[model samples]
Target: MTTQRTETTTLWRPTGPEELALVAASGWRAWPPRLPEQPIFYPVLNEDYAIRIARDWNVPASGVGYVTRFEVETEFLARYPVRRAGGETILELWVPAEELDEFNRHLVGEIQVVREYR
Candidate 1:
């Protein structure tokens, strides 16, 4: 069987040239002992805030059941929504396996938060 490779655009960046929001990511991908890409990101803030974020992006929480604290830079990011760095309503969503391929077809990258601790 072939695993349907898809680009999961889990990060939702709202309108405007918003400042990047820091993100830390750990997931159930290849090389379980480590991460594949830069485990840090600064995408715009979405809706889910913390709990929802953990569900979609964090490795510990991606499975059938688990809890992880992924948002470490919330206070800092909330500072500049209208200033130099605008923002978005950060949210973590699970797209249907089929749409994953075209979810962020034109997007660039994932929303990976910085390395953090629970």
Candidate 2:
């Protein structure tokens, strides 16, 4: 018998450019840990959701925001539940603060900025 390798899928995360800078500082391999006050890392399912957060919340609050795209192993994604918030089209993956390192291990490649709001 043989075990098959799980394929990876793409996901988007919206954050301030400062946060993205932190990711780059890590050598483009993983995300920085969530802030002390942040309990979860929300990686959304669609670009629309990411863009909205970047544009509406991050930009308004910080003057700059970015939408980042990356790939995650499908097998790892099974460990958590996806959640919906704000509206029907808004969906996100809830990565607990403790599980973030494991989540980072599943990232397939560099996290790239797909869009930016300033």
Candidate 3:
């Protein structure tokens, strides 16, 4: 008998201190719910884009920023289309706020803090 390996898609997210705290509170297993004004939970496709956001955008806003890496089951990710928010390399998976809980359920492993900026 052969064992089948599960496919997973790696994703990166740039976040502030507050959000990182919440992620930690979940034991690094899930993301917190989006705020009222926040309509989407977007995880970028590349680490470079995540680094840029963490260093340039998030750090300035919160004094510190973090770049987190995580994996989601590729089959579940198929439901959401990749979105380009800016330049060509700015690719992301846009999971609607309402579907975030379901999205979290598809996470393949714990979210990791790959890099930090201050």
The lDDT leader among the candidates is 3
Worst 10 residues of 1 by lDDT: 14-23
Could you give me the TM-score of model 2 versus the true structure? Answer: 0.92
Off by over 4 Å in 2: 1-6
RMSD of 1: 15.8
Clash pairs, candidate 3, are: none
Report the lDDT tens digits of candidate 1 across residue range 9-53.
233322111112112221211111112342423333343444343
Q: Write the per-residue lDDT of candidate 3 for residues 37-118, one digit (tens) a residue.
A: 9999999999999999999999889999999999999999999999999999999988999999999999988999999999
Candidate 1's TM-score reads: 0.26
Work out the TM-score per prediction.
0.26, 0.92, 0.96
Rank the models by TM-score, top first: 3, 2, 1
Our tally of clashes for model 2 stands at 0
| lDDT score at residue 34, model 2, on the 0-100 scale | 88
How well is each residue in 1-118 modelled by candidate 2, as lDDT tens digits? 9998769988999998678889999887799898889899899999999999899999999999899999999988988788888798799988988889989999998999899899
Whole-model lDDT per candidate: 0.31, 0.90, 0.96
Residue 8 of model 3, lDDT score: 98
CA deviation > 4 Å runs, candidate 3 = none
